[model samples]
Target: MAKSNQTKSKEETGASRGRKGDRADEIVTAAFEEFTVKGYAGTRLEDVAARAKVSKGLPYLYFKTKEELFKAVVRSVLTPAFDEMRDLMLASDLPSEDFLKGPFLAFLQDLVKSRRMLIARLLISEGHKHPELTRFYYDHVVSKGIAALRAFIDRGVERGELKPTGLHDFPQLLVAPALMAVIWRSLFEAHAHLDTDEFLKTHINLVADAITTGNRGHETS
Candidate 1:
């Protein structure tokens, strides 16, 4: 009888774990869509579970609350960008001009291509009401991004290839325009017949020109 009970316990444990895994994946997917469409306050766990085709109680099995689930979604969406940015920052031995232009453009391109653009905008729009969510993004996403950009900019200044502006604001100045462009395209330009690639290239060139110093445009091959 004891052996039969032990076997039953093991089977139940495995089934519970499988259910937990499935529920976690479902909740993450649902959270992504809900956050993108409804923003933080507008989203609820019951709604997410319904979208995921699971019981409303199922999401709580994976995520204790909506806030926790949102954080998980933010982390999931932002991790790839953070990894790419980290790699670009680490590969600093490349020419400063190429270093600045190459990764920055690639980053913008990825942002344009990603679904997270919508999620990011939603978070930004409703950030004040969900201070913890905003704070999580600040601590995880924004701080890391700013640090990487600052390191690159500081290197450019040291190499004499770029002008040294106030480092505090320099990081934002370098990236904000690109971010705004993403927002505009995602929110408005979908209906307009705009040449996105051309616009991106033009914007990148303009930004690079503004930051680059000296007569030698021959810095990078």
Candidate 2:
């Protein structure tokens, strides 16, 4: 009977995990839609539940509050991008101007495709009201991204492929254009009539040109 009880407990554990997974998926999906359309401040748990077709109370089983749900959505979107950038940085045998360009280009493409611009705008708009949520985003997403970029730029400088800019400025050089691109596409493009891909390609070229050393006989303007 003890052995049978152990087997039953294991089955129950498996069942609980499956239920938790399902619930988490539901909440995330719901949060994505609601947050995408309404912004974080405008979204409600009931709206998420309605969108997910789950009981309103069910979201609490996965996330304690709407802020937590929003953070989860942001994490779900940005974590993979960070990991990809980290991997690209790691796999480079030598740091060169073009070496950094590939991962940044790929990341920019993915960022544009993901409509994360809308999510970012929402975060910026609502972040002031929910300082904790904004702080969490900084701690988890932006700070880590800046650190990663700084490391890559430092590597390039050490390899003599890039100029010896201060590390503090290195992240700004690498990240500012990408941030500007997102803002332009999401916020100003309607008025500015900008083509995002074209803008991204041009921006990438400009950044690559700026970072590469002339001694390497690489083209720089």
Candidate 3:
């Protein structure tokens, strides 16, 4: 004589005062803004809900808590970007130095113009205080990116296309330029100027000269 649980769930979803007009995505976007601007500890669910134009309780129905929303915001901002990086890394047949240092740097350039840099700054500024979020970002973005570079470096060394250096074993060294750009742009843009494209190219040439036995000259596109 009781309504089916599935039907009850449907009814509840429909009856939810905040569910009808609210979407998880909108909340995540708003949370991205809040988390990057006010930071994870400072952002509130009600503020996110207000920004998303939903009921004050709407974000909870989707995120359960601010920490969950913070992770979601990070994922939303980063997942697609890195998924593109994964695709680019796999499909790139350019020289290893060119591939790893070229489009990858370009991707970081684009990210600086987006909210991703803010999120990166947010993580760096607060990561020590939030180990969980720190681990999530490291595992998902940092580790994955480093692994890809390591594999690419190994392949290049084996093929004799790139000089075999200890660099392959240390992937963090590979992307340091990109991370430095992010930090410099975020924290010191006014005090100093950085030409990101030029910096990336110069960095590549320096690394290439150190790690390549080839006769290839600087190939900036």
Candidate 4:
């Protein structure tokens, strides 16, 4: 009887933790929607709780404040996907041109399609006003992304696949078009429908052409 009770207690605790995790995920998803639509300054915990279909006070139980919740939203949504991409960039033996044209390009396209882009736009427009958000985003997303891309570029140069030019020192240049796409889609899509797929593909090819030694003939002296 004692052994059976102990097993039952362990199962109950596990189930309780699972339910808490599920609730947290629901809250985070709802928070993402709210933040995307409302912006950080405009979003409220009560609104997020309502969107999550939970009591107003419940969000505070999980997150002490809106800033903390916003951080949680990024951590849950964007960080894991980016970390996977970074890890792939670090580990893959694929040539830099192929990697950029293939997996890296695909990742950027998918990012434009996801809520991550919405939040990214939000960060750009509002992050300056909120130092915490700016710092968190930089520390968690921007710095790591730049480092990973730099490493990837360095590897490409070492492999003789990419020219040892100033471009290798500035990986952000490669991704600038993606950020422009995100902003344009949000601000001008109705006026001018951006062909995101075609645009990103073209951007990837341009980067590949600019960096890859095989295309050096295309460059001017």
Candidate 5:
């Protein structure tokens, strides 16, 4: 009888934890929406709680400050996707061009489809004022991504698959178009439609051609 009672207690505890976890996710999702619509300085924890439809003190129970909440939003919305891309780059032995055209292109599409661009806009517009937040993002996310791209580029060059260019030192060249797409979508999409899919495909082909030795202007099929 005691063993059965203990088993029931453990099951109840697990369910309690699951409920709390779901509530935390709800708060994070609400926070992301608030931050997207209102810049960081304009957003308040009370407003986040209201948006979350939770008690006024509930957000405080989860995140002590606005900064913590903002970081949580970043982790929830951005970190996992970047982590997946980094892992994919690390594990794949495919040709550099193939990797860029396939997995990297997929990642850029996912980035555009998600709320990540709004987060990027936030970082670009307000990062100087919030040095701590900027550093946190760079240290936790940007640096890791850049390092992964650099490793892949270096490996390709060493194996004679890529040209002996400066790309290994500056991997930003690989994803520059995605950033451009963010800016264009934010500022110019109302005036003119930008076909993002074709844009990215062209970018991938151009980059593949540039990095592939003696393969200038060759289109990727």
Candidate 6:
């Protein structure tokens, strides 16, 4: 009977975890919809609960606060993207130019396919008002991105694949154009349609030109 009880307990534990995982996913998905529509400053936890169809207290059970929920939403959207990027960084036995033209390019391409782009637009729109959210975003997303870029740039410089530039120290510059493109797409795409693929190609060309020691052909395609 003791052995049978242990088996029951193990089954219950696994089932509980499965339910929690489902609830967490529902909460994050609901939070994303609300946060995108209302922005961080304007969204309410109550609304997230409603959209999730969970009890009013269920969100609190999963996330301590709205900011934490927002972070979870960002994480759910970004973890896969950055996981791919981090893995790419790890396997980067390539030149800086090729790195940019390859894995970095792949990340940018994936960016357009995910909800991280929406989260990014929220960060731009409400980040000043919610400094904590901005800080969290930078601490998790921006900092990792910059660190990866810095390492790549450093390696490029050491191997003479790239010219010595300020970007080696401040790799944040590499992400600026991508952010600008996201912002433009969020705000003005409806007003004046812009070709995102062309924009990304030009941006990559400009960055590659700035970093490459010799004349390089633009091949973002």
For this target, which candidate reaches the highest lDDT against the unseen true structure?
4
Q: TM-score of model 2 relative to the true fold?
A: 0.86
- What does candidate 4's lDDT look like per residue over 55-169, in tens digits? 8898899999999999999998899999999999999877778889999999989888777888899989998899999899899999999999898888778777898888767
- Top candidate (TM-score): 4
lDDT for position 163 in model 6: 89
Model 1 lDDT at residue 187: 73
**Which regions in candidate 5 have their CA more than 4 angstroms from the true location?**
214-221
Q: Estimate each model's TM-score.
A: 0.80, 0.86, 0.83, 0.93, 0.91, 0.89
Computed on alpha carbons, the lDDT of every model, listed in order, comes to: 0.76, 0.75, 0.79, 0.89, 0.86, 0.81
Residue 68 local lDDT, model 4: 96
In Å, residue 120's CA in model 4 sits off its true spot by 0.6
Tens digit of lDDT per residue, candidate 3, span 1-221? Answer: 25698898878888775654448878898998888779889999999989989899989987897888887876888877887887777667777766656787677667666767788888889889999988988888888888887887787777677887899789678668877888888889899999877887787778877887673343345
Q: Distance (Å) between predicted and true CA of 137, model 2?
A: 0.7
Runs of candidate 4 with Cα error greater than 4 angstroms are 215-221
Least well predicted 10-residue stretch by lDDT in candidate 2 = 212-221
Backbone clashes, each candidate: 0, 0, 0, 0, 0, 0
Error of 3 at 126 (Å): 1.0
Clash number for candidate 6: 0
Query: Which residue pairs of candidate 6 clash?
Result: none
Off by over 4 Å in 3: 1-22, 215-221
lDDT for residue 191 in candidate 5, whole number 0-100: 100
Q: How high is the lDDT of residue 79 in model 1?
A: 71
TM-score for candidate 6: 0.89
| Model 6 weakest 10-residue run by lDDT | 212-221
Model 1 agreement with the true structure over 84-151: per-residue lDDT tens digits: 77776767566566765677667776676678777778766887787888789888888888887887
What's model 2's overall lDDT? 0.75
- Cα RMSD for predicted model 6: 3.7
